[model samples]
Target: MAKEKFKDAEKGNAVEKEAEDLENGNANADAAVPAPLYPKMAEDPRARWAFIRKVYTILASQFLFTSAVGAVGAFVHPIPKFFLSGGLTSIVVFVAILLSPFIAMFPMLIFRRKHPINLVLLAIFTACISCSVCILSSFFGVKAFLEAAILTCTVFIALTLFTFWAARGGNDFTFIFPFLFATIHVLLVYLIIQLFFPLDRIVYTVYSLLATLLFSGFIIFHTESLIKRHGYDEYIIAAIDLYLAGVNLFTSLLGLAGIA
Candidate 1:
């Protein structure tokens, strides 16, 4: 009986040690894994769709507001005349162009925390951009403006659909970043050159064509980034990116149509 009791005690001690080892192994495994960086939108369809809806809603609103401002800027005699009078030679228009980007960025930086201040800043930025667009549109006339608007809409819709299809097929656009960066730099150089040596109509047309293609690609990239990479909380930034893409695409098309 004494020998049997001693054997049982030894068995109990071994089982306890094995159990402790298993727990320690689990703890180590848990420690080895890191937390996720963004919300798991991929796993939650509803959350993903909600985020997408918010982004597009804001984008549409901005577009409509811009369009209204553009229309006003185009029709009002004084506004159009004032903007086009001196062309690039006009000090007021030149100053506005130089300052517009900084003005737009200021609001984006200051009111980034989601407040009424952001809305106010967004309005100001949109107004500035709309004024610029109006100036460009006035040079093109009503017919060119309408044609460009139609083309822009068609292209935007098509690209958006393609982006969704590609994403569903498990394709990410990570490979295009380097090419986009290079192309954009080349375009910037061309733009700077044009500033010094005004390009002829044919060259301007070619530049506009290239710019349209580039911004179309940008739309795809920005949309995919919004859907796959950005967190749900980044709706504001995503909206801004998409809005810029749309605006650039429209302007490029307008130039290609020989209106700007």
Candidate 2:
């Protein structure tokens, strides 16, 4: 009887051990299995490529638009002068000049989101500026026009190159912005004062020189932003706005330098 009882207890112990081993095996197996990685949770590989293509297209459009504006300005240069008198000329130029920043930004206003319209607007703006200069020069006298153009172009180019050098050559130009703005505002106030007086012929010249410097900074600043943050979607309008600013600045500088 004793032997039989011992045998029964051993049997029970063996069964329990076997059951535990089975449970352990199951637990190990469950732990070994990996969860499925859902494709939908991640960004598609093709999305990046599509964005890159769109950006390239936007940039291409900007180049094309800028060329078109330049052509238009050149074509318009030979037309007979439209208006005269320093007051009338100044008013037209002022309106156009003041309107420029707004015009350049028009695309941004329309898109309700950032897009390439800014680029294209910038290009158109540049063309308008060149045309304005050409027209002013046509009436102002050929010699004066040429002289102004030369001056404007030279100053514009210099500013661009200098800014580029600073950007690439290791100077952080972002810090200079406040100084530039302050200087510009002071000059603008002076211009307003001169406008009221009309007695100082020299004021316009000083204003022109100041404007040349300011616009040069603008070109660099705009172009830098274009390269950095504006992105592919903003190219078209950005280009137009920049182009306008450039041409307008150049022409205005030319006009100021040329006009008596």
Candidate 3:
């Protein structure tokens, strides 16, 4: 009887020791992974409001520059003529303008967090991309360009206001990102195939509409992300996110207007 009692005591001690080790292990694991602090930053009203103001200010400046460049490209008679002219000089200029955005993007991304340099790089990137956009706009002429610009602005404002209201109501739009990402990849593949075989007019129209909606979803997602997910120091990235979505939406709208 004593032998059995001793054995039982040993088993109890072993189990207790194992449970203690398990608790320690869990504590270590938790310590190893530091908790994210963005929630704290995002929760502060002053910080959140400041971040929003900075991001929107930068975005507004970019759009102003883009609008100025677009007007010059569309309404300036000589500018359109020069770009449209089928000559060696025109071809060279067109190719350079097309390639400029890619060239600027690399440095802009690299210096995205480097303060004054980052701002300079952002300006260069904005200029290059805006130039490319305006060049494309020139091809559609003044009336279509103006209409698309107005529509893009109106849609952007409505979406911005809606996103703010939705976010304030505790709506999370980040879940749609995976679906949007997958669909955009599929659309990209379809567009590449179109280079070899031209799509039917109806098909192209459908594609354009799909792209416009996709970008609209992106704007909403990114805007909500700005409100809830982005860190305090991520203002530049936030601006870029909104700007890219707006530009893509504008291009898609421009395509529709051109076709119409």
Best by TM-score: 3
lDDT of 2 by residue, 1-260 (tens): 99999999999999999999999999998676532122231333244335434544654454354434444434454443333344676577757855765665555457524335544554555455544444444555555555655665566567656754554455555656687679779976876777787635576777777777777777676655543335445545455445555665756665575556
Tens-place lDDT per residue, model 3, 150-251, is 999999999989988776666678889999999899889989999999899899889989999999999999988887878877877899999989988888
- The residue pairs found clashing in candidate 1 are none
How far out, in Å, is residue 33 in model 2?
43
lDDT against the true structure, each candidate: 0.79, 0.56, 0.86
Superposed model 2: Cα runs more than 4 Å off = 1-82, 85-108, 112-131, 237-241
Off by over 4 Å in 3: 1-42
Ten-residue segment with the worst summed lDDT in candidate 1?
A: 34-43
Structural similarity to truth (TM-score) of each candidate: 0.78, 0.52, 0.81
Model 1, span 173-198: residue lDDT tens: 87887887788898999999999999
Select the stronger candidate by TM-score from 1 and 2.
1
As for TM-score, the candidate ahead, 1 or 3, is 3
Clashes of each: 0, 31, 0
